[model samples]
Target: MADLTGKRIVVGMTGGVAAYKTAELVRRMMDEGATVDVVMTEAATKFITPVTMQALSGRPVFVDPWDPRVPNNMAHIDLSRGADAILVVPASTNFMARVAHGFADDLLATLCVARACPLLMVPAMNREMWGNPATQRNAAQLRADGIVLLGPVDGDQACGEVGSGRMMEPHDVLQELIAFFQPKPLQGVRVLITAGPTAEPIDPVRVLTNVSSGKMGYAIARAAREAGADVTLVSGPTALATPRGVLRIDAHSARDMMSAVMGETPRADVFIAVAAVADWRVAEASAQKIKKTAGEPPTLSFVQNPDILATVAALPGGPYCVGFAAETEHLDQHATEKRQRKGIPLLVGNLAQDALGADDTTLILYDDQGRHPLPRQSKLAAARELIAQVARRLPAGRVPTLAARPAPGSPSAVPSAPPSPLSLP
Candidate 1:
């Protein structure tokens, strides 16, 4: 998420040996297309030269408040004008206390206090200095004043004695900055997502599965997390790493997937069925591997797997259902029919050959308003678009509970508190 394109940032450096790392931070921000302005305190010059930072940032670094650089002689006020954000990298304990106490002793403090932009503080100091009670109170006060703090990560330090109080790597700091700029489109929404291809075992070694790579699903999960949703990913077998901040549940077969989905769906605000589940599983899977006979191949019996999407959509007051259709031909017809049949509000369709195990996709979204084609793009971009679409279509408030179904063979029986078992665990 370190995509800082077109952003204007002021990177502030304070007195700390960790100021050496601030050069990399400024370089990285510039690499991400951000126009960076470096501001250094007097003590900061001892650790890293302003000339080095000026070369990296390709701009004059600010050192003195009255250095005659600004036409108005208000360098502190003019510097942050039109700026999107201000970052205090390698924020020393002294600077933290100064910012916390609103002391404008120098340009960094003056600009930070006078700026209208969002402020982020990246603390870097000795473990003892960071752990001091005064520093802790100052940090707390800054947080109370709505200042965002990145990290003084735990690791080996310049002083050679380390537990905590090391600056976060430049890449991580950029990621935090990116996240800060992202819009929380899915805030307070609980999303349950299914990903990958479910296996239907025929024997210990033989099974039926598909070519799904789970890339799209995982992308969607990551997008949802970025959008500030509480996400739970119910996944079949895949080698992909879990997205940050997403709770993942592993399921190997269609049955296991159903169980996991059922367990989590009730509390979800949205449910996206992206897993390619086996249509039929072996009725009685062999305990041992089945050997081929010389005369003929062994016959196998099959049974239908639970219809997870349809079952969830049919439930009383169920979450908003979104189904995926991977069709070889007649994509529109199949996608529309599937959406209607499953009683889902939205359906995403793409060619099986184009999407299966592929990073880029051309998606056709089917919904109440009709079909909309999204041009081919990377799965991550597509996922972001999809999340935006869902956020727009979400109801004003929670959907009202549906009328309860009558009990079997008893028309007058009262409704049960929970619906009947859709799929056995």
Candidate 2:
């Protein structure tokens, strides 16, 4: 069955350039067999004409509750009565605050106040407004009230200022709407993921670390959670916020990360190794910050840190382990070799330069089945594909994969879809 077929969605548009996108969103949702009711705020009407929306929806766009032409002037009440969910695209700071306060001055807020269905608000505005404490507080309040805030994507904005606060694209919002109703296929599973670059302390302030920003691992954790898994994310230092429902364990150095993962890995049903662990640490020295000597330079002995992926994969009663191979050159060869050497049933490989810190990546998933190239997509979308692939690889009735014999990353390794993409976005 189509997940969103015949599903009712109420889309709220506010005063922003993004409001124009809502008309397209309405059409797309309809294409997916969704019945969408457009509710436009006064400010929203300034951006997208009610006539245009009405033509696209083939239904009157709800603008005011007290329009005398409408029966009993109850347009707001009737519009939201049977929605499967509500999506507030182009949700402005003003609209957010009103929703946060249960203000019903506008038709959109009135509908939200009266609706019992799931509430999803996609906030779109200037980055500064988005970052303002009051706006953030309102968003927090709305979330706490069971409002699902999708996105105000980051990048260049209509106002010429940039940071965040752009509404999610129509297709993305539509996909989210579809996924919302699908059966949680990976439900009841427990996932443990390690992400970001593990630091190896040298001098007091100096440390060894890579360019990893912990995007992939954390995205996996999020995807697993959305699929109904209990996820524990063991992450190294990074600027990303922890996803909802994920238990985040902070780690600094490779040793710290190893200890944390070792402690949690056993209980997980699936373990994905995505962290770029520092290869070596200072053997000894530096009780305080090392001073730059006026002479030549100082030398420090280095010791290799434990290979976290290899260690975790080898555990007798461990979770089904997955590893990542990030290479600068010969990406496929190295990833395949790492996959075999690490003894993981699955390995996610990608180019470090293109995949390192960017929001988009193309992955080559290596396994007994061979390598499958997953098209470049946002980290969030890639995460979903990876979760689904993991589910398929695992044995039926369990989240563990069936035994597969392979030549170990051999040139003839079975190909599937590309490995999951990770991004700091």
Candidate 3:
């Protein structure tokens, strides 16, 4: 899944038979953890009820420009006040013209004209209307104005004739939404990441593993991909879905994860070791499930597991290595020590109790320079910032052009303050 945990989106619906599809788009965005506000033109309400949209978005649907919902009767501006993006689904030919010509006759139109965020529109219309020279001219103008036009994908339309003008499927539009928000800072770079807790077998049915949910690692993979890196994720038994556009390899144990990472590290430009590998494994795992005997408990011998991060970092000319340290105490001390011990350029530290299996995280970056604290936020947001920080530290020739910073209204645009040392768990 593409992580949109803290993204704020405004789904602008225009009147079209495809207006029904906008409901699913809004639901999909919200499903990915984005907060969606549904804005509708009066003509749009004719196709889909405001009640249905409101129910899906969990916020009041805005349709009337003079709606009392706004303190100053400025629904047009207020609805998009802090939005990260404005997506117009089933953008009718009329709506396209209105937008291209800067018309603000309706609330939706007014919002488009007044929005400070990126405007993305998915067009839907009759085949002839889409082919009309006038509509083409309007589209050209929209493109010229920096308005992103997704598609009036060629296919069957609501009308009997089927040449072009079908709205992009809700899921496809959702993919575009994810792509639009992602900043491609690591483009042309290949990132190899290990995530989740590697399990070491005590027996066929029992194993030793940590509390890792793979959320942070998975979040990093998503962020890396969004940063335009070709990401390969080596996961250890995570229930989470594969992030879109990532190559995923599964690992069952520490040895398995090591093999996977070592195999991919040669081609990677960056390597992130986020998995919590078992520190020890049974010296000899039992082939059969160990049975408890009433007389005495079976004695199990243990041996040290391979140190994945240290091993990778020790490799000659290895990818820029980044390690993760989850400490319950002495976070800064341990994190800094680990970076030196592992011979890595960067090490990320967080409280194990605070981050394990959780959606939110507070991270501190430890390097030769000093400690840099990142504000507590969703793992996805933190991952993006982490990637940016890594990009900045990359050797000059290896670094790629990065996407611009998040716009002023985005949650990520919030200023960072030094986190209190006492806050570490």
Candidate 4:
């Protein structure tokens, strides 16, 4: 009934006090588009039993390898063939040993050893039991055998003990399972993004910068990485730490921002202007702090910075460019004008009051298809939606479109080669 419509999953339960958690896992996997088949280890039935699993998964449970009811009909082969993947939750130390040693003494173990599709295992046990060197070695072997190992997070345990080795919560495991099934949609695609707030210098010790916290942009970078895009994050000064697995080029002034973005635009498949770049900068920054004389406020001259988005879009056969607009009024009109004038394929506009320094945002995507409103959600979710739209709209490649060399005497400077593509996916 949830989003999963066509996926087929095989859920195996093993002996552990946390075995009950597997029922919720099966239910969630089914709700998210999976048809689940449940199998229970002998010891697991002693904890939560199989009738409950049968009711939750809507499939009869399998416990013994020699059980004639399902086997006479070639059910084992059928069950193995029907699933897209196999998942073992509450993978106890004993079960891990059985799997590692290739022992198929039970139905669940037999199916695991027999499945043709991919296998994923989520370990859950007491901290001391999980930390056993034998269990660690078995897990390493599983990884080497190409099994997907979901997290066994560190936290308090059910046995009145506290340390490493807790099963990841149901929701988090669901996310990992979904991500595991997702196609590398952005494979080999290069994306360039600008983030954070550029500083407008007033003096050595004072600078004017907006309240842009860079959370939204950083979230987008992570989502893009998850989507399998090689992402380059051109960032301005922000207090936030750089997200691991992203290429970050720091910029302080509008000039530095342009240089970072320009250097990475040519080879990019997509360019996102998420940075709140200062429109104007002090005409001349004081090399040192200007001391106050306790008199009238000093005047500072300002000059318009180079329009980076427009400059990149004007490149001949440039990358597919997208711009962001943080507007409070006349949002549609302004976004439409910016999209047309900047010649960008897409413009993502959100209310500044709702978006600035926030972790959630609602966005209106202005593109060739007109406006599509994305309801307020986590910045990561919004980023995924935006990227999916971009992917759907991406035209099949015809040629490698490099940025145009600047014409002689042009005001905007040409950027160097684009950053080499890298992705967490």
List ranges where model 2 is wrong by over 4 Å. Answer: 1-8, 11-183, 400-425
Best by lDDT: 1
Q: What TM-score would each prediction reach against the true structure?
A: 0.80, 0.61, 0.65, 0.63
Model 4 lDDT, full chain set: 0.79
The digit string of per-residue lDDT tens for model 2 on 1-425 reads: 24468798888888888877888888988887887778888888888898999899887777777877667788777777787777888888998999899998877888889886777777888899999999989977876565667776788899888788887788777766665554355655788999998877777788878888888887787788766567899899999988756899999998999999989986888898889888888899478998888998888898888988899888886778788888989988888888889998999888999899888788889997778889998787788788888877776544442223223223222222211111000
* Order of models, best lDDT first: 1, 3, 4, 2
lDDT by residue (207-325, candidate 4, tens digit) is 97888988888877766765656789999988887654478889998889999888888778788899999999889889999888989888989999999999998988888888999
Report the CA-based lDDT of candidate 1 relative to the real structure.
0.85
The candidate with the higher TM-score, 2 or 3, is: 3
The superposed Cα distance between candidate 4 and the true structure at residue 408, in angstroms, equals: 47
lDDT of 3 by residue, 1-425 (tens): 44688889988898999988888888888889999988888889899999999999999998888998789999888878798888899899999999999998989999999998788889999989999999999988876666778777788777888888899889878876776566655756789999999999999999988899999999899888777678899999989998766899999999999999989988888999999888999999999999888888899899999999999899887788899999999899899988998999999999999989889999999988899999999998898899999878887664332343344234443223201100000
Pick by TM-score: 2 or 4, better one:
4
Evaluate model 1: give its TM-score: 0.80
The 0-to-1 C-alpha lDDT of every candidate, in the order given, reads 0.85, 0.78, 0.84, 0.79
What lDDT, from 0 to 1, does candidate 3 have?
0.84
